[model samples]
Target: MTKMIVGLGNPGDRYDGTKHNMGFMALDLLAKEYQTDFKMEKTFIAEVAQTFVNGEKVFLVKPQTFMNESGRAVKPLLTYFNIDPEDLSVVFDDMDSPVGRVRLRQKGSSGGHNGIKSILTHVGTEHFNHVKIGIGRPKNGMKVVNHVLTKFDSEDNSEAQDGIFKAVDAIKYYIENNDFTKAMNKFN
Candidate 1:
């Protein structure tokens, strides 16, 4: 069976390296590690790359739609590929955990994440997998929007990179084992 691994983030150079794009960053790293590259697929409204893990077919996707509207791209891709929602895994930034932390869950609420919210609405389920890289909450009364869009400060960059790498490893583990619970037990 084939599986879809989605990384949540806004498209364009403007969004690169921002705290909100941790998912994209992790996917990029995964692609490079696997010696593959992403290509934009207009029909899917996403940048997609194909790779394999433990002999299983896998697709790595980065939705081209902006963050809040990610499902606009995701749902179509899922339908086109005839993939079950349970076979989908999502990577995204999470403010609920501190930097350098990676968390895994089989399913859960969006936790105020707009990108995940979009997926839940369009995909119509909370039963997929989540690989979250922590960005930590904004401090000193900073606005949430401002914090997400902004690049990580110098103090946070190293930690964020650690989190992203950990997230990628977690995804690899999940895809190879085909067991979300095992991945969660090992990584979370």
Candidate 2:
């Protein structure tokens, strides 16, 4: 099966440096590693790049539908490509983990992330792989929405980059081994 990676984030320049857009940035890193670029696909309502990893074809995607409605981009692409969810992987930011940390999971609930919730609903299953980069939750008196949408600090920005590199390595491991568990064990 062709491997599919869906990186969740809002579209446009306003969201450029926010932690919420970590997924897109991570995929951007992957694209750079493969020396490829994304082209906006009207059919999928997303920016997509195609490249090979360990001789396996991989599709890197960034939904143009924005963060809360990412499923709109993901579902159609999966259908159009006739790709199975088992061969799919999602990369996104997670507030539950601390900065500089990431966790890989084979399956899980959305953990209240609207983008992930949308994906779960559209995909009709929770069995795909998740590569979550830590963005950290809001401190006392801060709102969740504001925290995610805001740009990261110097410390968090540097740490998030570390997490992105780790996520990229984890992705290569997953692609090479065809095993989510192995990626988790090594990178999480």
The candidate that achieves the highest TM-score relative to the unseen native structure: 1
- Measured against the true structure, the TM-scores of the candidates, in listed sequence, are 0.98, 0.97
Candidate with best lDDT:
1
For candidate 1, write residues 130-169 as lDDT tens digits.
Answer: 9999999998999999999999899999999999888988
Q: For residue 141, what is the lDDT in candidate 1?
A: 98
What lDDT would candidate 1 get against the real structure? Answer: 0.93
Regions of model 1 farther than 4 Å from truth: none
User: Candidate 1 at residue 135, lDDT?
Assistant: 96
Residue 134, candidate 2: Cα error in Å is 0.6
Q: Give me candidate 2's TM-score against the actual structure.
A: 0.97
